[model samples]
Target: MARWESGAVEPDMATQAAMATIFHVPAERLSALLWPNWLPMGELFHVEGVWSPENCHSLLDASGDLMLERRGFVTLAAGSAAVLVREWQSVGRAVPEFLSGTSEDIALGFEGRLPWLRDLEDAHGGGRVRRFVDLELQYANELLRQTGHGGAGGRRLFRVVADLCRIAGWASADTGHLAAAERYFVLGLRAARAGGDRLSGANLLKCMTLLLAEAGRPQDALLLARSAVDATADGPPRVRAMLTVRQARVHAILGERDACERLLGQAETAMAETDGQPCPDWALYFDDAEYAAQVAACHLALGNYAVSDHLLERTTRLQPASRQRDGVTYGLWWAENAFRLGEPERAAAHLSETVPLIESGFSTRNRTRFAQVRRLLHPHRTLPQVRDLDARAASLLAWGA
Candidate 1:
């Protein structure tokens, strides 16, 4: 072992195979670790009808970078990354295997269920939607692994799968499962690339940025947000605006007021340019109320309590019925800011109003945010309204249990 470690000797093929078997890893993986330079090109990855050797090499290089940044955020694009273009070009050639379902039927099915599923997510929470989406993803992946479909049908199917994965990832993040969220985002990106959907991949990166930003790694979040923007530089106006909002959020986290406001203005401009252009299904939800919420979050982060309060009020009033999660979330923020501005009674009232929705099993984000509000109001626990609000929140939070 010492001699092998010192590079005085190399393991024979038989020994390498034995080592791989013992370690429960593929022989190719073992070889790459031991004699990487000595192995030929095709030997790098022994498996696959999916990715070419070049693609595998790119992914392998990316895995190294991801490992280094494991605790922080990892950018989706790898070295020499024209990932979307490459995946687009390689689509027909990469996998000749046929999938079972007609892409049209699958598409129709997805469309029929999407609205209901989204509403469920809003009303119930990520916990309710995640398992359902996860199962769909699993089935879609299995279909891709089969033989029978190819060409445009295959690409269409892949895109649908990608979209489902994106939704699943979003749900996971809503539940505060950041690690699971990252895995789904990565998988979703691969499926998006395979479908030649650059916009979808860019959106997944944006999701990652949001996840990292909320997890408190602002530097990493800023880098990922920039990557999302660069990836979709010339994409749809609404899509660009969506990504720009995330970038603005990151800037806010980093305390860059000027940069945040600049990007927010750019987002507003992009939204205006969207005009009559067909918005992607994924971006249809980026409405005025949502934009207002994003702005409020930025200002709230930057200590502009009064401005944020005005925006939050407008947002909750705009579409309270449609945006269940947003209404509850903005309500929590309003309460927090109210207390910050030395209005404990207003804060208690705001919290009181939002508590019923919080008990609706919507998202951990609302619950978590409310907990922070609770902490903020703790110092004023002697106040009757504050005491009542605390009891109500605690009871709501412990309802199912």
Candidate 2:
């Protein structure tokens, strides 16, 4: 695409007008001036056989910063930082959160008390393996700051920053940046401390448990779940429930069926206390569907596929459109469970919808889980839906670099 303000290319009348509005060009030259900065989303995405460079240039408004920010917000709006990172990865590049390739994360990253964010981004190049550890480091730092930074007002301040850290960490984890995700979880812990919110601390620990399980370190994840329980032994009922839900998943992943069932009982007890009481600030992450989805996932991991399917179907019904990334992610899990229970056609149907959602997010963490979907498709490549999904997965897997 040509630069929006550049006096280089000559333009047709319509193109000039469109470019002028996009770039704030002087009205006097609207008829004669070429609008250089007009790249479309498809072109910016570099979708193969989708759009020519010229068409892309025409579609974009042509301010590099504007273009980058627009694209970045699109990903964020979709509740997916992973998608943004993945697409950038696909292009063999790593653009900073501010969409800058010219600067290092530390020097120009988001200017809050988030030094850890930079560290998380710097740890990966092309998708090596996972960035969980790096994310944990950041999560730890954020928690430290959030839990005790402002004395009496510490909790409130921590609330603000910790929220960002949590989202960043979860995003990192969802995308398969395990190290980076872990750092965010740890940072969230510190934030809980700074805020003097024991409930928040417990929530962070629960997050750690989930991350550990997701990373296939089920034993360690189970230990983290115990720690979460111990940390929040005297905390709010809902907080306790969060920990139990987490523990249930960890135990299920470890194949400790008895322990997982027990934890599920505990989670139910905690949930029973929701008498319209205000939720703890840290627990804001979970609404109804979020809770149901976690429960369903735990069941799926435990080989109780029928119950899992029922719970998951309910969860999907309750899932708000706003939770697109999570909804899609969980939908993939449901499909996997269906496959396990011998429903190939349903699996294919789910995969067809899910592959596009995952692509839009480009999250490495979700991609790791999504590998299950890919595996299922690979075996049934002769099927139309399976072949289509396999191709999409292949394109995305290339970004795991």
Best by lDDT: 1
lDDT of 1 by residue, 60-136 (tens): 23332211221122223232123433443344323212233454554556545666766666666575687777666
Off by over 4 Å in 1: 1-106, 147-150, 396-401
What is the lDDT for 82 in model 2?
31
Clashes by residue pair, model 1: 98-147, 98-148, 98-149, 99-149, 125-362
Please provide, for model 2 over 316-391, each residue's C-alpha lDDT reduced to its tens digit, 9 standing for 90 to 100.
Answer: 8998775566777788888898788888777878766777777766455456667757676556668776766666
Q: For model 2, what is the alpha-carbon lDDT of residue 105?
A: 24
In angstroms, the error of model 2 at 23 is 44
Return the TM-score for candidate 1, rounded to 2 decimals: 0.73
Runs in model 2 with CA error above 4 Å?
1-150, 388-394, 397-401
lDDT of each: 0.67, 0.55
